[model samples]
Target: MKKPVAAVDPLRLLVAILLLLPLLALMGFGMLWLWQSGYLLYWLIAMVVCGVLGYGLQQLLVRQERQLLMNAATEPNPEWPPSADAVWQQVEALSATCNPEDWPLEDGRWIWDLGQKALETVAHCYHPEVDKPLYELTVPHTLLIIERASRELRRDIAEKIPFSNRLTVGDLFRIQRWKVKAEKAFNIYRAGSILINPVNALLSEAWRHLRERSFDQARNELHRWFLRAYVCKVGYYAIDLYSGRLALGDENYAESVTPESKADLEQTEQTAEATNEPLRILVLGRSNSGKSSLINALFRELKTVTDVLAGTTQALEPFVLSREGFTQALIFDSPGCDSPFFDSKQMLITAGSADLILWVSPANRPDRQAERQFLDALRSYQAARMDRRSAPLLVTVSFVDRLRPANEWHPPYDLTDTTNIKSANITAAVRAIAADLAVPAEQVIPVCLLEGKIYNVVDTLWSAILNHQDEALRIRLMRCLDAKKRAEDWVLLRRQMAGAGRFLRDLPEMLGKRSEH
Candidate 1:
């Protein structure tokens, strides 16, 4: 058993008093010396000068820190909704209406009120039909949003502002209390000093008012800085929730690709990339457009059978590609769009799941009506799903060797130098394909996927793939998030079933107990 001790120990109290007596006596003696020495005025002036300098230094540091936080606050996340610009403008306008005079330094309720208004601004942009969008969130999800916002604010403050980690709201209140008492003591001193030395007191009063004005301005700026950060960060997460971008259980999927492992895979091929779901790349084009040859070239070997006949690939074939400098992915060789028996609906479903697409169009083929129609349908399908990111498309204009200067087969053909007949023909073919497919010219890469003569396969084509990997990774994240959400739904359903089963078993006993009562 432990013995109980009093709140204040007598021995400790006595020791503290013993320690404080000498400090008090020494201060009294120093004051007596200052009064008699007649150099007290000079000593006081020095102290005032030092205090002003210290205050100026602190204000400068605070200004720089606030600037950094403001920069971060004003920048919106790339994944935010299309109305993010207008939402920010709305928030800024709302903030402009806030009166600094009404917000006291010690009171914090005004921030909560301002945050409520900010959340309404965000809800107006995302879900105007609902009168109370915030109330629609589940308790756990609301708490999660708060936790994420608070964590970001803490991280930014501790890292960007010096000494912020060491301070707290309680410390600020304590400092405010000290400032009040100091002002009271200075007022009394000024009253007495004015009668004794009129000129000195007048100068001191002017200096004190100047410092006070500067302090008030700094204090207000600090208050507004915190206000902007709080509102912006909270609204950022709120907009994410309302727009269906932020959800629970995403962290579990994100954890599969850690920083260290991703760095390893990107730096060296010896290390295989870790991923819960592989990025899906879909290959689409007309029949006999060198689709198989292009896939074989990407693999650096013959992985798919290529025939001179059309409609060789009748179905979608998926291949696992874990190449160097690329995320682990599944590349699907889709059936050609020109086939008479092709199902456009099934192809649309496959396109929806793809993260990156490689459209193989032969440079020799002039008939592109079928391809153009299919592309228009694909674009319409993607446009309907506004919440999902469209897969990046790269057009590979194959069979460039069969262009106008058919006799000239060159190893290196610079499209920029159009003076050469072969280069000019290839460039014209690329531009025509780009215009027909409604894709950017830069995305169209002319390649000869012919056997034993693969031009632009290793450098030009692979570089395009690598460049689109970041966007592909983003699409993959959304894909994984949807799968994880479905899995979570199943888990929650099981839990609810179990709870209902237990309640049914105990129903009779509870009813009997209630009757007895």
Candidate 2:
């Protein structure tokens, strides 16, 4: 409980009365003497007037102080969202003190002192504790709960509170109480008692601000107090979400895939020892749609046979593609989806073993009905063998040069500005084909591949491929899908965002339930 400013010193009061007795006796003797001399009548009238005026002023001050105190005591706390602005400001002020120029050495250390005062202030109000000395409460006889709260907050936030954050309702409610305690601390600190401390003069200066109605000076101190307790209550969860654990590209996908990942790696090694490669990606599309060319481009060599025919490659052709910084991957150039020879079972066998699937289509083709059917069948087939997670599909619209005026060749196309004929054609084709295939617009990429020619192949295609490869690896680790499984980036992000949204939405309810418990 919050102790009083100081214990009552009865000995001092007794000494004061004893000392006043002689002065009182002398004044009585002088007054009696003056009355007998008949000269006290005028003085008595003046004394009575002065005494009545003093009593009236004292009563007025008392009434006003009591009203303000009652108003402050009865003020209901605001809800989380409504009070968020002040709480946010409070958090920022505390964060700013982390690097104070005037008191660099005392930056976060002062927070502990403030937190102690806050806890004691709250205890005094709600707990059945008798008034005691502040020195006793703050120093040698400090409560365990206040000490632990300060220590935990100091450790969790690294002693530097966060400035701006999406602090949940739970955090705000907890902080609201700390804020309450802090304000009470200020009220007590203003009493000018013998609660000796290093900050006594500073508290007096802060309390003096109320004369001018400048609450910031005192409220700022209270804000610092609230921040420490806020950190103790909600800081850990804040740091976790702020770190972006759910986002992709995090090494190990923000999780340690330890013992079980090793087992999966061993099994993968035994099964694919012949290739000894970590990943195998398949480039599949309609015949003559640049599937073979894309593979050869990835290899930077004419390793796969290419022909301008509807069914040039009637079988699967595998080649190795390696990059300086990336793991070596086996790239397979599969037959066109329209190739009459390959049935549904054959399609899965060709695609089932691959770690990733890259679907290529021509930007020049206006109708993708055939390609759409093939993709749908492939998705179902891949899903049946793999988990519901579709294999990471990176779709590339190759032959962008073949999009416009047949003769027009362009190295770069600004898809957004549709005035340029080639760019316009490319934009329209991508939009139409993407809409027709029911795939996200971002997945539909435009590229042109020719030996010794570079266009969108590097700028667009390779970037998307490398990105999808990482997700594919993460999924492999997740499902132990050595045989074949794919995870889409959109799917991963959507699920992550959904989970986050649910958490934020349910936070108030969770706090209510916990409070009941």
Candidate 3:
């Protein structure tokens, strides 16, 4: 049978001190008044008498009250044994079980188990009918359990891996920090709050740690924890967002594929060059901006058709195209760059490693998001190059054939006839879009990559590539990419510096508040 829990007394020994404070203050004040009136002996006598009387009365009252309570109390029960010995024994056992040699793996497992138990305990203890006790007792207990678990895990990791070894130490610290964060998140979750951010952060860090190590044990541990963490995060976020518990605002929540998202990571062990390296062409635009159709059209002209959608091209697809001089270059079709889903950081990282960037846009519907992303990516590419020169920014205006009536669609236009009205109209339209994109008017070329009888569409693209194959063009492209990258870096650096300045300025005030507490 469970023993009845006693209510904690609000009035403790400290309450007596609080109650006597006013009387003591008044007595002191009276003595001071007497002394000022030239009654020093009287003041001293009164103070001594009151101090002795007050102390005696407080002690006597407290003793009598305790005696009365004790007389009314029931007989002591032996069924409920004291818990101190059992708790100490458990602590000793735990200490003995946890060894430094077993380190991160053993400690990590222990923490994981403790966290699960704590969660279960709290869930069982929580009662809407007994809100105060449930919150005050159960919530704190849960936090302590999580904290203890986290501390144990951190200590174990620290002991197992010395700080000097970059790989081991870095991975261990990352995992430990994540465990701490997970504890904080679990606390928040118990209060009916979402824990997606921390869970995501934890899993992300764990993924990095696993990727850094080749050891089977570490890798297995990482995979297990990462999956669990990711499931928790995804489920929490999905529930909260769908149920209107979390705000989505205007931010895009498109799933991003990180290095850790790969299922067969062993494939990554191979050199990047061994794979079919495609000339990654980045198509940028808003949704429904004909970016998909443009790729379709290009593939159609090349006598091929492939999947088209943002992130549809899971991996870069390389297509070999032969030019007039029997020259060939690999062309790559990439995922469309759309607003919200367009990760500039990842895109720039990819662009830095690409040989060329084919910036594609549709003639009918132009998107500003696509234009801006392209420029940003190009800038990043230039910055990453050894020599800062702009890569050949080949701008292609797709679906030009759509401008004419379907039945009257022509294959090619007369370049020599400057007075040709139809040719002039197409040229003007292409130039206008180019101007909007901030690309040079001369660099923009209109090509109907989809037209069955497309005149010189392939030739035009090939010619542009051939013309810029020289060392000078390479140098120029590199410079342009570098300049753009530098500009972005400057902007980011300035913002970061400003933020640091603000933090420094406010630190003193924060510290002052903390000290007072």
Candidate 4:
């Protein structure tokens, strides 16, 4: 256990007393010598200056203690984050008497690898039903719950700004500009007595800790108060919002809204006019490979129904995703490769029209021949005009939990961990898929959209996308959108040209005019 050190610790007091005694003795000796030399004025001045300096030192210590307390108050809360130790233990213990095909513990310790189990554990901590078991949970629904919870958590964190630190006039202006959102949340909370009730106990506990001089404890309590107040109370509306989005579905259609007032209608018109359209992301894959589930996961809402049955998607479905911080994007969940009604021409057109393409394949499926064929065809058709390499393809491999040695779901595995069979298999799987698709290994991401559990898709997928978001490519995509209603493969050349119809349009027309013999 560590000992607590306060600014006004007893040791400092003792040191001060010791130093003061020595200072007094030295002054007394100096005064006596001055008196003997008849220098009384000099002795008096020296005595007063030394006394003031000693007093200032004490004041400095007092000020430091106050600052320390303030800093502690602003610090983050203590959280006992949930883990998958028990889950992994069960898997490892069960596989203890296995052959080489087994789940292994780390360094012979009880520690397991950090993968799907660990990911779900962390997510479950913020879950509305915190103690829910992994097997019993519904993956997409639970993830949607977690997303709402986390978003509320962020909003609560934002509310502490004005109270968090001292602000200059300039700081206040910047905060006001940034705090439109914070103020809105604050207003909603203040507008009701009901919203503040849930956090009353937390506030009381925090106050008790503060008065008892337990600064750290107080900080922890206040953090709980904030999180609870926003996520639990103010966030009650989130349930309705999520449900509405789910029921309404991701189907975008033309609609007309007439405001009651002229000014309101004008404002609505202005807002719509100013709004930039979101980027279109088309998810491609084989049937039953979790395309709809991936889209719902991204939205954090069960907007689309998921099933193990193939041909679940019948048409090209488009959904708008407005995740905070990123640009609003349109994500389309398309019909799987194996759909009986699958039109190759339409699939080619849809894939080419997208601003981004997410090819979701199953990790367990050894033969990705179906998806590979579609991808190859899609590329070849586009290559008739522009460089096929211009398209940014991010392949997401799902069902990673089903990879061999069934129950093993630890993470932190890599192509480098030679000792671990799980790691070796995962790396091999990724490499094989990358080779089949003719894409780099980095472009292929393995995720365990673990059924009845949210796993590695969100962070790993988004991170890969952001990394590959080149400035030139983004500008080109934006230009394509502007020139045409949708960004298509044919328009890719327009992005590179100074003017539309300069290259292909002119050349194609000339060739047609000459005709064949």
Quick one: best TM-score, which candidate? Answer: 1
Candidate 3, which segments miss by more than 4 Å at Cα?
1-315, 320-330, 339-341, 367-369, 380-388, 404-407, 415-419, 471-517
TM-score of 1: 0.79
Can you write out model 3's per-residue Cα lDDT over 377-450, one digit (the tens) per residue?
66656655422234456677766766644345655776445676556667776778877887887677777654
TM-score of each: 0.79, 0.42, 0.34, 0.40
lDDT (Cα, tens digit) per residue for candidate 2, span 1-517:
9977656467754675566556545555666676789977766666557655655665566556444433322111221112223333443344445322333222556555544444333333323355742333323124333444445554644433344235554776778779887665445443323233323334335435443343333333334434534432332222111221112233343133233323444543543433333566778888788998887777677777788767888776656566875656656677787787556577776565556888888877766788888788777775564222455788888887766587888567688886888788888888887888878889888877887665777667778877777766654443332221123345666888999999999999999999999
Prediction 2 TM-score vs. true? 0.42
Give the lowest summed-lDDT range of ten residues in model 4: 74-83
TM-score-wise, the better of 2 and 3 is: 2
Q: How accurate locally is residue 151 in candidate 1, as Cα lDDT from 0 to 100?
A: 85
Worst 10 residues of 3 by lDDT: 252-261
| Residue 200, model 1: Cα distance from true site in angstroms | 4.2
lDDT of 4 at 249: 22
Best by lDDT: 1
Q: Lowest-scoring 10 consecutive residues by lDDT in candidate 2? A: 74-83
lDDT of 1 by residue, 1-517 (tens): 9899796678865675565556545545665677689877886788678868876886786677567656766456665434465676776776666656766657778756766777778777766698786566777767766777778877877776668988998998999899887776556556656655565566668777767776777667766766676777777777667656676754656445434334434543423544556677889999999888998999988779999888899987766677888878767776789886568998998898788999999999999999999999999988877667689999999999999879889779989897999999999999999999999999999999988999998999999999999989888776766666666778988998999999999999999999999
Alpha-carbon RMSD, candidate 2: 19.6
Once superposed on the true structure, which residue ranges of model 2 sit more than 4 Å away at CA?
Answer: 1-277, 349-353, 381-388, 479-517
Q: Rank the candidates by lDDT, best first.
A: 1, 2, 4, 3
Task: Rank the candidate models, highest TM-score first.
Answer: 1, 2, 4, 3
